[model samples]
Target: MTPYAIATQYAVTLLPETDINSHFYEITVDYRGHGLWAITRHRECMNHDGDWDWEPIPSERTDEWIAAHRFDLDTALRLAKEAAPHVTVNGITAVEALARSARREAQS
Candidate 1:
């Protein structure tokens, strides 16, 4: 099977308005399938129009982002699903993709 990474977007709206912190973000989970996985989180930006959008911020891969070999693919996918309501992968939402996979599994 081809190695794939699941990218899911998330937002923090429940935080108090007075809280000065990131509100929009994306977390990309790269599962190596050996109980190893890496999580890279990117913060979304708000443009002048006040619309939330993604802007790739280039930076070095420091200790902040690294692989953790402690979970299986199922756990990784579950995490992807937990990022629901805002998770989009390859034009298809994570919930949709996961539901489709479930249907296929059920058929098999």
Candidate 2:
């Protein structure tokens, strides 16, 4: 049997309108089963440990379950770019090519 995995790609940045107290923004694309994918938004905050925390920004479209839906990688890429233009892998605007951006941030 082949391996079962849910691959996730993330693009995160500080919100421009962010208050000095709160800085947050995240865009992630997850590969769900079949031809489905999930584009999720997340915000940063403090956790119980007084540490950085991330929570999903829920929307009606993404909140509930559905039998069937259609989405494409291009849409996901656009959303991520809109969320953070600087969220690029080697200056590339396409989010699909930016899965390694997080690693770059981590390294730098």
Candidate 3:
């Protein structure tokens, strides 16, 4: 993300992937007020390094991860829309929000 791109004020809370840590699936909206580039990781605990360092989740593991946690991203998105009807996304689907942000960022 560009330095100009700031994080939106709100965060989308998702189901915890394990009883590991207090904050899991810490998804945040892009500066444009849409969740793109959301962080999806199991923050069960700090690593041996004593920090919560990690890598991005691979696409292949998405289904398995969700299954293990019984968490569905689509359902989370739907709930967000339902709870916050005032939030606007230019008619873009929440799933596509991040991709759209990435495209816009790439063009700059």
Best by lDDT: 2
Candidate 3 root-mean-square deviation in Å: 17.8
Each candidate structure's TM-score, on Cα atoms with residue i matched to residue i, is: 0.29, 0.35, 0.21
Off by over 4 Å in 1: 1-82
Per-residue CA lDDT of candidate 1, range 1-108, in tens?
A: 899966333232222233332132244445434455433334432322323344343354333222222234455445543543355556755445556656766798
Model 1 weakest 10-residue run by lDDT: 61-70
Worst 10 contiguous positions by lDDT, candidate 3: 29-38
Query: What is the Å distance of residue 90 in model 3 from its true position?
Result: 4.4
Give each model's whole-structure lDDT. Answer: 0.41, 0.42, 0.35
Per-residue CA lDDT of candidate 2, range 6-49, in tens? Answer: 54554444333332211233455555456554454443322223
The candidate 2 region of ten consecutive residues with least summed lDDT is 15-24
Model 2 clash tally, residue pairs: 0
Better of 2 and 3 by TM-score: 2
Local error of candidate 3 at residue 15 (angstroms): 17
